[model samples]
Target chain A: MGQTTAEKIFAAHLRDEPFPGTKVIDIDRVLCHEITTPVAIADLEARGKDRVFDNTKIKAVIDHVTPAKDSKTALQAKMLRDWAHRHDIKDFFDVGRNGVCHAIFPEKGYIRPGFTVIMGDSHTCTHGAFGAFAAGIGTTDLEVGMLKGVCAFREPKTIRINLNGKLPAGVYAKDAILFVIGQIGVNGATDRVIEFHGSVVEAMSMESRMTLCNMAIEAGGTSGICQPDAVTVDYLWPFISGEFASKKAALTEYGKWCADADAAYEKVLDFDMSQIGPQVTYGYKPDCVKPVAEMVGTPVDQVYIGSCTNGRLEDLRIAAKILKGKKIVDSVRGIVSPATPQVFQDALKEGIIDIFMQAGFCVTNPTCGACLGMSNGVLSDGEVCASTTNRNFAGRMGKGGMVHLMSPATAAATALAGSIALAKP
Target chain B: MKKIFGGPVLCLDRSDINTDEIIPAKYLTEVTKEALKPYILEDLSLDGFDAKGAPLKNAQVIVTRGNFGCGSSREHAPWVFEVNNIHTIIAESYARIFRQNMFNCGMLAIELPKAQIDTLVDMAKGGALVVSVDLPAQRISATADGREESFSFELSPFDKALVEAGGWVEFADARY
Candidate 1:
């Protein structure tokens, strides 16, 4: 049988002695933000290893706790900053320069097709949308990857997710992926690589594709990826400069990285997007999604439209279109954040920020804030937030807050109605 | 690290217990392990416990349902258990990163089917019972009245070796 995308990648980087099992493979790129980097720096110190495997391949960002917010967070960010400087890492992005690590990594061409990327944050799988074998490991393994350049891996079987048929009006990538997860429970793809394919997937934009891959971990997916195409090249073309020039020029050489036509997949799931609706999570989990049409009057206290999962320019544009020339309900507070600094600038130039501001939505710096309940748009007791971000686990946003996950359009419409409502089609 | 006479296995009885709940992102600001133990379940509501309410005080092992440790790849989740001196965890299944994090901390995370998990969980609910785990033998036994009811399990030899030699640091120290 022909090799799957995961099989092909692992085969190329497989180590000796372990052969097909427990292969020790080289990690091409690594990324970390303040919340994850400080502990990793401490790990390296404890290992008595002062050197990183390759400083150029490692990039650190100040995203999770931007502007510090508190003295402790400030100390942590400063520690990571000092460590990066002492190690002479060239790609360190301080606050205002860096944005959410997942969104900015691909924008900078730090993550490329056919290369494996690892990060301390769980959404590292977001880069897999570019046809790479990317995944999230914990801080210890992340530190180990920095010190040794290689990390252990077990070959994962591939689960092919076929996104067949065109999406119906008001339905989107967020709805489609949420539908797929609801079909198979959270642990449906445990330790398995999810390869999204089919005509529907082929036609999706890079930002939409990222939304699909970003939540793969929510389904217990080892990683999620989409096959690369001309769209991928166009998106990354501008970022090719400096040390990455020669490395990126060889992108065409990695053309053989996609799954073979004859490959034997472990399992294949066919999702017809035509039947899916504008979905939203009513409970405390991503997989608890139901059609927004059926959930019209579920009251909400806030609306959030940003995160690695749904904070791209297209997402912002969708929200802007729905929210323009309108004000949010008097009691509700809404916040919009761009996924990265460049996305923020692009939105500003395009007047998307004005649309949000005019709609009574607060625009904040590009950070993963409020998405993980750290800051910016955190919830108070008895509050319900209709959010575009991933995961709505209990106590996720606040000590006693509830979250409803939805698309930006849905989130905006909900804000306007002062309750969970469907977006204008 | 051979045979653990561990567990008055406290039952969480829940699934999708993400790392954020175990150790919230607010506490992740600290670089070192210091000040982490007190915030393991910082804002949880538990029964039969004091105001601090970290009920794992008397537990060396915890039992939970499937998809335990489901969200963000925070290594602090396992560190919370380790600092509480939790030696083992029994679950129906576990998220990959969380399971690996447990192994890296030299903490045993054993997965079994629902029926088996129910058996173990029920045994613990009988008050102050133990899961006598024999690591090399790949079997765990819960004894009563001088008779042993044993359950078999499968652990890859590679993982067994790592556990026997303690976890990541020891293995790395030997290699480097």
Candidate 2:
């Protein structure tokens, strides 16, 4: 009877009586966003349900299509805002206040270590940096989670992605994740729990760890998590209330929740971080990745830098460093949207904003915008664009548009040159 | 009204074909289903473009490694693949959500044993290989090698009806 990290977290957060691992365990946290919530609200209205299960526990945000570019998006935002007001969802983070859901969540204390957080977006695993069991759900299940504060899930078998040694400089967590995806292919870890550990992980910052966990969905994992430590405590301390004693007690309770030393796992993958380099996805899938040096010489018509995947402040700083003196290629269309207002402000204070503007790029406000093909920087027919955002499915940025997924560094380099570089070295 | 899916298997050897690769995050909009067809298999093909004057045309069956359809719970995923003529998929595994989406959309995701996948990939080197997916028997057979394989699946009443109707949208339309 061995329990894994996720199993332990799930047990701690079980809403009702616990059962065997075979049963579909109901989740504790239910989060939603603009694109997915409107329909859920409509479903709730149709069902004649007036109130949500628990206003305090449930969360909603306006990350998608906010600063509404057009009437449709503005209308969509309004609809989401109105729904949140109507439901009295206390944890709702609206536009101006909202950043990327994954980044802003832990900051606001909506996600605590050892808690189970479920959202309607794929990168819910970003909360896993705090040792929480965070996973994504669909619209219908989101509707159910809104009403019941629970969504059903089975216990996933675990896979240990162990890293050794230090990552090479400029080879960030995004590259590490892309490298793993390249090795395992997409869907390599479906219905599986992914727990990242090792010397490399321990050496990485909490933010970097979040970036890795954020893309666990690409591996078909239910949830991905890193164990909590001092960095986790420091990251979370800002959002807690009451005296330090109360918060420390809660944190201690969380510390005890990590998977016991003898917990079972189905598979283990060991990789040396020293072998990884700056990588980018050449084609539509995140797993369609290659080393930066090897990926050069591909032509590009557009370049974008934004998304929940790599749209953080650090991502912007990295891109800004690359683009400061270099001008965007005249033939290429470059769009830079920050992940959040906080990121946007940080970039502004750091002069990253000026560099981007000087480079002849369009810097849109924070939103899910181009990441989901709704707004800014969509591709025209037969168009090819390199983007920092995750995914490159055709018509993803725009109909008839060809997408190449990459890191902000790669995206910036592509924008400057108007072609995928053969080598940034 | 039991339906049959007949299409040659254009086997894909790689594993873990994520949903983001199936349909990128950018295309989650567009209320209409018809708009998604061109993007099908856009990443896997060499042209580095979606369908429309591409080399690989009318590819029906896809063979891949485990956990096909990972990332983001987008229903539009299976809809795009189903409309694109990807009738049957032989994979070593599948993501839970993506597998459920495929089933709901009436696509047969046959999980073959890994050893058989190797033989199937070899057979597909020259051209398309014919793989028969018998839903009633829950068995997948590769005609080139003449090997029968078993797949683990649980077809809900809703999915069974959709598969019986030939496709999901058709079943959805029929219900209306």
Candidate 3:
């Protein structure tokens, strides 16, 4: 049988066959954040197994509730800080240096093709855009990955999603993914790896690929992956240059991670990108999606553009382009948060921040606060928000607030309209 | 880890019960699992379901529809159920990570087919339902309104090992 991309990665990392269908694979990288790592840390401490397997392989960040919204949150951050310091883990990122874990780790070239990555956060699948096998794990698996550098998984089954045709001008990767999730429903890809292929995926930049893979969990996918190609080599060039003889060499090595032509897939799904338009999620589920035209004029109390999913420079540039000379409506509050300090600085240099501020948006530091209802721009009771974040689970942003997930362009247009609106082509 | 265990069944007849509804993000900062008890399902909103009322008051086992505990990879979702002494969740399906988290905690996340789940839901609605799960037999028996019914489910060998060892921490301790 021809091995799928995920199967090949897993075979390379295989350490044990724990059971008939489960493989214990060695992890290349373990990502951690304040919210989930503390529990694993506490458990490790109680077991007297507090040492990390490999310090250099672990990347820790505190982006969830940056600046410590409360004493409890402060304590959580402090625990992670002390633990990171105790282990002398040099890759730790604190408040100013921190960005969303999914965003910053890849920006640093921490992930590579065919590598296996695990994190306590579900969006760890975002790293799979590099052709790596990355999956979100829980505290127990996180503990094992941190202490032993190995995690168990059921044998992977790949679902090939072919994105053919061209995306419309105003549509973006976020729209493409949302449309996929809509077609597949929320649990459509459960227990399977989604291997994205076809021309549409080939044309996407690394940032857009990350955005698409970031929401794999929303559709219950173990990971969403793209084949490694020139774009992958280009993104890692600066950090990987010295390790490789040339960009061509890097591409040749990484290209080995692509799936075999005859690779067996559980099923194959084809989506025509030209048929998709600006998409928005109504109701609470991520799959409750509709074209922007169907949801037009739905009033929104806030507009947020930031998260591991859509807070990249491309997201900001597109949103800024829509808000350049226009101001958001007075009643609709708008917030823009760049995903990383690097993204923030780059946006600043590109005058994206000024454009957002001039358009009546609150520019905040890089924290994953408002995305999960932690802080920065949480909505009030009965309020509705047009957001670019991944999930739209009920009360996700606030206890009684509603979130309508959309692309950055759509969110910016909604900010100006004070209601759900499609971005103009 | 008892081989046979179950209790009063809590029926939540809905699909896609996400982690946010299982345990909201606001309580995620709290360090201890016990701190998450009061907030369990605090944000869940269904037509006839009450977050603070009787349905969840004594739920030791939960019977729900498909994709239960979807969204977010927070282990806190299962931890809340652990703190509340509610360990078993019967659903048509579960989000991948949440299901793993449940098994890692030495709890049961039983997945039955849609027809089986519909039968169980129907049984629970008839009257108060108490379920007994037998791990060795791989069977669950439901008793309600002087009637008894049974269903069978399968657990992977790895998950069975996780339960037998009393969670991943214990399993890792022995091996690592």
Candidate 4:
């Protein structure tokens, strides 16, 4: 029986056959963020299992409500900081040094092909872009991963999503993924790994691939993965140069993680990317998508472009290209937070920050605060935001606020128009 | 752990009842489960649904439509329900992580067919529906306005074991 990439990775990491069709797999990396880890740390402390299995294997960050939105949030960060220090986990990232967990982890080369990674945040699936089997787990599973270095799962199954044809002008990985989610509905890929394949995926940059994989959870997928090819090698080349003999050698080694030509899949979906347009989500669901042209002139009070999904340097450059030499409408408030300090620094060197500021967008520090309605740029009640972040769930950005998920280009265009608008090709 | 449990049913009557609706993200900073109690479904906007009012305050079980508890991998969603003593959730389907989170917390997240969910929703609309879950038998029965109906469901052996041991932590403590 041929095995998919996810199956291959699972088999390689298998530590126990706990039950029929269930495997206890050794995890290579355990990602932790303040919002969820504090509870796990507290539980571990209560159980007298306060030690981490491997401190180096764990990466901790305080990004969610950075700068301590309140005393409670501050305490959450404090608990995680004290725990990380006590455990001697040196990869701990604090305020100013931290970015969104998904972005910063990969940026720092913590993920690699064929690794099994688990985190308590849903967007942890973002790391699957590196050909790893990464999934978002709950606190109990996270604690187990931290303590025993293992997590249990059902035998792996896969849904192959083949994005074929060339993307049309102004269309991007965000649109292709949004279109896929709209077809699958929210629970379309439940309990299954989505292996993104085909020429479209082959051409996407790492940033775009991360954006695609990050929303796998939105479609109820365990993870979204891409084959580790030359693109993957190039993305990690700088950090991994000393580890591999050469880029070609690294590519050949990572190539082992790719699915077999005849890999079996539970379901296969084919999408024609050329048919997609710049996409925007309406209503309160990420899957409630429509071509931005269909939503032209729909009023928006705010525009936000940042998150693990679309806050990378490429996303910033794309939005900056649209906003250059232009000013956002007075009725709209625009904000952009680069995904990491590196991305922010790179954008600053490229004058992307100047473009955003001149265009009236507030450039905030790297933090995931506003996306979940914690702080930074939270929307007021009844406000509508055209955002480049994933998830349009009701009140996701604030109480009674509406979030319309779009690509950074669409978000920049909407900011200029003070309404939902498509970016000019 | 008890194999059979039942209580007054509170039907959300909507698909895609996400975690953000169950427990908004702003409250995630609170480390204790009890701190999440008052805000359960605070941001949810369904017709005639008051998150803090009698309908939710008095209910001990939740019946909703497809894709219940979608969005975000926040265990706070399940913790909020656990704090409120609403231990069972019946739906047509669930978001993957949220479903697992429920099981991890030693709570019941039952998945019925769409047809069975329709019957439950209709029964719930009849003003007072009481649901009884028999875990050993894998059966769920609903009674409303003198009418009694039952449906059969299945849980994987692993999930069954986890629930039997009262969550993953307990299950792991014995083995790991």
Candidate 5:
């Protein structure tokens, strides 16, 4: 039988020889955020477990409700900070230290090829861009992972997505993935390992690939990964302070790195990126997507470009290039949040932040603000906003507010026209 | 696991019933799990669904066509159902994380074909439907209109054990 990518990762981590149904494999890294950490700790304490099993391997970040949204969220963040401190966990990232769990880990080199990672946040699958076997778990499941430094999962089937040809002008990785979801529907890739191949994925930047893998959850995919290439190597070089050879060696040693020629997939999806367009969701779900031309001139109240999904440096660069020296229309409220502290600093050094500010945009700190409707920039009743975030579920930005999901370029264009507009550059 | 006789399998009969439809993101920050009860199904566009807040009142079983829980892997979707007296859910299929969330919370989710679900919904329409889910036997039997019908499903041994032990946390409590 042809082993899937998940099986290969599991086989490598298993204590015994791997013929997998379920095994409590060793976890290399585990991630928790403020919302989940409190619940996990409360569960652990109730069960008489006083400490995390492996504090060094665990990282806690306070991003979602960071800068403390309310008194309750503030208390939870403080509790997590104190607990992480008590554990002497060196990787613990407080509000200012870490930006977003998914983005910052890769920025700091915590996620690399061949590693098995699990985070309390579903977007943890974002690390799959680096060939990491990452998945999301519930608060209680996180407790189990913390208790034993491992968690068991049913080996999943694999789905191969081949992206051939080149994307059209103004189209991006976000549009491609959104096109995949639109065709397959939300649950089309349910519980499967979605592996990307062919020329289009090969051409995407590490940041763009992260955007693609991050939304695999939107299509009910467990993990979405692409084979590492020169782009990945280049991205990791700065993180490792320069380890080109070692990174290549580690990835190669993680045998069964790619699917075999004869490997069988439960489903195979092919996309000619030429057919894709600058995409945006019309309604609540991420799969409710349409092209920019179709959605043009749909009025918007606010436009946000950030999140673990599309808040990286490249995303800001593209949006900034379009919005340079042009003031955001008087009606639209433009906001951009760079994904990580590194991305924020890089954007600042590159004058991207200044361009955004000059366009009358609010360039905020690296927090998942207003993405999940918890913190600042929240929408009011019956308001609609253009967002670069992943999920646009009902009441995502605020109570009775609607979100239209789009890429940073489209979002910037929306700021210019005060409606759903496509990027021209 | 104990045999559960779930009252009136409320046929939502929709595809892609996402977590947001179950509970929106606004109420996600509210304290206490019980606070979700009023907000449950508050955003779904179901016919006759009261937007002012109409929860699944006495319905113990929720039957859907396919993809019962799709977008967003919020475990609270299942947790909210478990808290609001939802014991068993019969669906044609479920998204990955949502199904696992259901099992971990001991809110039983069983897969039945849309054809079988159509039959079950038809039977439900005939009169009051009493759906009995046998966790160990992996069978769901429905009694309605003075007739009884049963269908078989499958569950992994580990998930069955979790169901038998009530929930994952409880199972963890016993073992660890």
Candidate 6:
């Protein structure tokens, strides 16, 4: 029988096709971060599972708490490192090489195209950039994936997001995504694969494409996918050069990466970028976004310009320009976190870090820190903080804290005003 | 294993009520099942939330709109309902990830009709009302002032077994 792109991918990965509707596909990649794995390992040890099914296939990275910054947090990071070394996990990116779990794994080639990826972190959907089917699993599920290469899953419906026209100046990929979330609301794509196509997406850089797929989980999609185009081939060819060469030699491969034109989808959403503007999430949710011009001076208690979502070099450049020669409002605690140590170094080389520090922004090391309220940057009771992270549920950054998600530019501007401020030209 | 369904539900029609909203993310640090009770629905009170807020109060089941749990993989999402006396949550739809998480933890997430959602919302705005859900009948009978409406849902054998087992822990315990 003919099948959709989703069915084709599933069938290729199916180890035990339990039934027509419910199939158990072999997981291609498994990712675990410091926070979730420690307890999970403890649970496994309790369960008497002495050895993992395959350590090479497992990638554990330390990212949640880093640069230690304090004695307690330093101990946490050390514990995670010790566990990784003890387990013989092949890919362990410590503090220096560590980054947000989703960003680091794909960059390292642990997540490949047309493969099934599962991670303990919720944003595992970020790997869908390479046309992979990735999803977040709980600790129990992670335990299962570690013990066995396959994970039981019910196939989800696919959603086609067609994009056309070039993005307007100042309206970056993050805004386009926030605009999509606003239209669809948070749960619009529940249990579905979101495929981006048409001209606009074709024009995006690989880094920007990663940004787009990274936020798919914000609107509750199972994963976000962009087909393997030239950008994908170029970005992946570096790390997987040998694998790509060998795979190319064999024309007929079981797991080919391409989206069929007539692939079935539960819904199709069209986004015209010419009409979009720089978006800032107003109240709390990612979908609660409006153009930056309309959101300035809304009053905020904090401004955070970082997270896996927008802590890249380009994001810092934008933020630094807004913050240069200016001071963060006394009431607001301004924070800047580079996505990786390399990003931090690059920002320093570009004088972006100097600009940020001069503006009274506290610079944090690469980790999913303040984004999840784990470390020092957490918000206080009823405090409204503008952040560049994905989620904005109440107290996401701390107890009773209010998080307003926004672009890095907007966050920097908000830092200057001690409120939600638009990035003025 | 104990049976948790076949009880009356108190419907909440809010959509996209995220994990943080269900039981503020801070409470998730507790590492124990019993600690989840205090934070459930902490965001819903007419008075702005105090950390000491009681969950679900005297509620049984909750009925809500589409995409009820849409963000974060914090286990607190389902633990909120289980600890707060919410036996089943009937929504028009639910977030895929949250639904799977809830299912794994032994929660009965039933999808019901949207018309009843409006009625439930109206009743909630006025005060409290009773919603009866019968898993065996595959119908939810919503009751208020001599009026009873029945809504239908599709259930798999796995879910039926889960409902019969009361929840995930009990089901696992029974199996082991």
Off by over 4 Å in 3: B1-4
Clash counts for the predictions, in order: 0, 8, 0, 0, 0, 2
* TM-score of every candidate relative to the true structure: 0.95, 0.78, 0.98, 0.98, 0.93, 0.86
Q: What 10-residue stretch in candidate 6 chain A is worst by lDDT? A: A246-255
Writing each residue's lDDT as its tens digit, candidate 3 over B1-176 gives 34235899888899989999989999999988888988888888778888787868887899999999888889999999888778898999999999999998899999999998888788888999999989989999999899898999999999889988889878876786
The ten-residue window of minimal lDDT in model 1 chain A covers A241-250
Model 4, position A143: C-alpha lDDT score = 85
- Cα RMSD for candidate 3? 1.2
Cα lDDT of candidate 5 equals: 0.80
Q: Which segments of candidate 5 are over 4 A away from where they belong? A: A15-20, A239-251, A254-256, B1-5, B30-32, B51-55, B145-147, B170-176
Clashing pairs in 5: none
Number of the predicted model whose lDDT against the real structure is largest: 3
Candidate 2 global CA lDDT score: 0.71
Off by over 4 Å in 4: B1-4
Query: Which model, 3 or 6, shows the larger lDDT?
Result: 3
Give the winner by TM-score: 1 or 2. 1
TM-score of chain A of each: 0.96, 0.93, 0.99, 0.99, 0.95, 0.91
- What tens digits encode model 3's per-residue C-alpha lDDT throughout A1-425? 78889999999999988789989899999999999999999989988889999999999999999989899999999999999999999999998899999999999999999999999999999999999999999988999999999998899999999999999899889999999999999999987899999899999999999999998889999999999999999999999999999999999999989999989999999999998889999989999999999999999999999999999999999999999999999999999999999999999999999999999999999999999999999889999999999989889999899999999999999999999998887
Q: Model 2, A1-425: lDDT tens per residue? A: 75777888777666542234432345557877776566557656765764677877787788877777676556657777887788687778776788778766665676777777777777787788778888777665566567666655665688989888888767778888888878876667777778988888887777678888888877677788898876677767776545357656756766776777888888889998897777877666667878877868778998888877788888888888888887988999889888778888888999999999999899987777777677777677888888777666546677677777777877888888889862253
Question: Candidate 4, residue A146: CA error in Å?
Answer: 1.1
Query: In candidate 5, what are the lDDT values of residues A1-425, reduced to their tens digit?
Result: 66667667878887532223655567888888877667677667766885877888988888886788688888778878887888888898886787988888888878877678887778888998887788887766787777777766777688999999998878888888888888887877888888888899988999899999999888888888777666776677677545545866544544346666777799888888877779999977778889889999999999999999999999999999999999999998888888888899999999999999999999888888789887768999888999989888777788788999988999998999998988886
lDDT of candidate 6 over A260-315, digit per residue (tens): 66667778888777887788776667788788778767788878877778878878
Local distance difference test values of all predictions, in order = 0.81, 0.71, 0.93, 0.91, 0.80, 0.72
> Clashing residue pairs, candidate 6?
A300-A419, B106-B168
> DockQ of all candidates, in order?
0.62, 0.22, 0.87, 0.81, 0.46, 0.33
Docking outcome class, model 4: high
lDDT of 5 by residue, B29-121 (tens): 544567677777767867765635333676788888787777665677876776777878888999877887787776688888878999897
For model 3, the TM-score of its B chain against the native B chain is 0.96
For candidate 3, what is the recovered fraction of reference interface contacts?
A: 0.90
The global Cα lDDT (0 to 1) of model 6 is 0.72
